[model samples]
Target: DGGGVRGLSSLLILENLMHRLSPEKDILPCNVFRLIGGTSTGGIIAIMLGRLGMSVKDCITAYHSLSRDIFDGPWRPKAWQTSKKVLGLTGDAELRSRRLEEAICHIIARYLPAEEKSALFGEEEIDPCKTPICRVFVVATQQSNGRRVILRNYPIPYEASRDMTIVEACLATSAAPFVFAPLTAGPEGCRETYIDGGLGNNNPVAIVLQESRLLWPRQSVKSLVSIGTGARVPTEVKQNLMSLAKKVAEMIVDAANEARDFESNIRLTEPSIHSVYFRLDVAESMARIGLAEWRMLGAIAQRTRSWIFENHDLLNRCVVTLGGILLNCLCITLRYLSKC
Candidate 1:
């Protein structure tokens, strides 16, 4: 579920599944989940759903609106060229900070009023507890030492609070190294830059499992479900790489490999967990950002219903299955290979 833009496909499928649960409306009640953890785009959806209490439709609308601007809007990479050059930190070196500001603005626009933007991103420190949602964890990576920074109900110093807004923190977690600038969050004195949480935990289901155990030690996990973007890798490798194609191939290989591993490991250890992965027409929908993509999401959503019908026992006996399947190392391989 953590393949850059491809992750949106998973979110779309999730929206549909939520609708199926209620059938009448898109709202997923808070009781449905004990805790939620996400990486990158997954984190964005989790925050809106868990913290902001936005409906599935609201989340979908917001993401669709931002899709176009992601590559060409003010927050687009290198969009802050002038600022970077004037600051004497020219080239792509300063693109991270520039894109960071743009991402912050985009988030502020999504969650806050125009008047509140300045105050939210300003010097005044706001308490995290005041936020509506607290049972959410955003996984991020610490650049200096490559630590997995789980952003949840942690203590923050005055300076860190001043510099980091919830939007900024989420953006920091979503910032893919090299693709987007690494973020300098935490206390002002702390030099560790935070990057995409995907570097460490793309599936992030483990975060939910581990944190749930810590928070409610006595309660056994009731049900566990995960939705992914298939996370399939191509079996064929092109022997020839010419110029830019080589770099692109490398990036592709890295993502496909990571995604494959994530799905494979989850299936082996957690078979009872109902996992839905979008496998049809993934490549066509990956870079797209429009109604067409939305339709594709709808298609994937329908497929989930079919999957559920086919695997009734998996959902009904999720808890029992989890216990029994603990030692089952069968890797549920994906049927389709995505071009991500």
Candidate 2:
């Protein structure tokens, strides 16, 4: 749950599978899945895929382009550009956060048609009818109630303003403390500030499952897949915030596991794949940021590749078993008829 680029690994794994399954560039099989939910970096990916309806390949490329801006500093104002700053102040954390949010919104806008953007952004809530994907949710916590806020295309509650922008929602979900400032939604005085939803619900499998149940109450979810960056145990204990962060990490892992098990127990059919990388550590080290991104992403690709192979094998075995059962049933019926 450490706020780093490692979370992108989830998308990488999904992209790898799509690449192997089809050689086609712009077409992907993700349309089979109805609802999409994510937190932090994953939340950004979800907005791109589930909200904007961009192909997986395009999403991957767009993320790659934004990664440098996100990880490095992309919001630095040019020395001559005084208007970009507040009272000649530059390098402010909040300003940079806003810039990054704008960059992301720009990326989201680029993928959508001109007609769609006006409808999607012009309103307080996205017009779900205009979106190519049915439902998209990005998790963010309500600062006041400590409620896990699932930001959807749907309208906000009656008390809150109807004009909660898409850019604001995503920035709130992805904002990591110390890295980015907490974001506010709704009007001043009554506005709620939100932090990273990962603190409340890191893996958003439950949201997707809840939607599925609503859509098809009598049927079980056919498959539920989750991808996570690897977790690492604290090597040496530190006091205060660092110590709290470690404890929170442990809590997140436990909660995520419990959520996964809970889903499995209730579902008529079990999920096929749930991958968590416990070996990789992105949160532990803050320095050498560039190197960390490379190593973590490299490990994710290698590990995800193995998962892809294993799942492919499992699918093949299922096909063979079904074929054999069908053949045996046909042969038995033919012999009984001949004897009669």
Q: What TM-score do all the candidates reach, one by one? A: 0.62, 0.67
Q: Give the clash total for candidate 1.
A: 1
Residue pairs in candidate 1 whose N, alpha carbon or C atoms collide under 3 angstroms: 96-181
Instruction: Give the number of the best model, judged by lDDT.
Output: 2
Model 1, 258-321: lDDT tens digits are 4456557768886643253222223322333321133344454455455556645544444343
What is the Å distance of residue 143 in model 1 from its true position?
A: 1.3
lDDT agreement of model 1 with the native: 0.52
Index of the highest-TM-score prediction: 2
Candidate 1: where is the Cα deviation over 4 Å?
A: 29-31, 73-134, 154-164, 235-340
Error of 1 at 139 (Å): 1.2
Error of 2 at 269 (Å): 10
